[model samples]
Target: MTQTKKTAKILRCPSCGMLVQPKDEDFPFCSDRCRKIDLGKWAMGVYKISSPVLDPDVLEDLDGLRDGQSRDSDEQ
Candidate 1:
């Protein structure tokens, strides 16, 4: 006879760092309060998703695009 072992996955809440289960109502957050706290942080600009433009070509292209857009808007 052969036997197999089962392992359960573990997850932690992002806001409170509490252990959370996938089956929980909040899933990733420990509670509704914690979930709202995370949302508030995003709404208040406490969290930002940004990266510096490293390539000169990409920067020039972006500036050109912006200038074109502004000219188009002014023409309208």
Candidate 2:
């Protein structure tokens, strides 16, 4: 006979710091309320990307692409 153990990963709700499971309907959040709260923080600009883009060239390329796309659409 052999014995086996099961392990599951644990996560916390970003809004309330409540322990949550990946299998939960809300996954990272404990409930829809917490999920909406987290989204509201983002919508209100409370959360931000602290790190700059890794590639300066890629950023410039993206800006150029945006400008090109806008000009192409205007000409159409």
Which predicted model would earn the best lDDT?
Answer: 1
lDDT at residue 35 of model 2 (Cα atoms): 92
TM-score for each model: 0.63, 0.60
Candidate 1 to truth, TM: 0.63
Best-fitting candidate, scored by TM-score: 1
Q: Which stretches of candidate 2 lie over 4 Å from their true place?
A: 1-7, 59-76
Question: What is the C-alpha lDDT profile of model 1 across 1-76, one tens digit per residue?
Answer: 8998888877899998999999899878999999999999999999999999989999999999999999999999
Give the C-alpha lDDT of model 2: 0.90
Error of 2 at 7 (Å): 4.9
- Candidate 1: misplaced stretches above 4 Å? 1-7, 52-61, 69-76
Q: List the residue pairs that clash in candidate 2.
A: none
lDDT of 2 by residue, 1-76 (tens): 9999887756788889999988889988999999999899999999998987779899999999999999999999
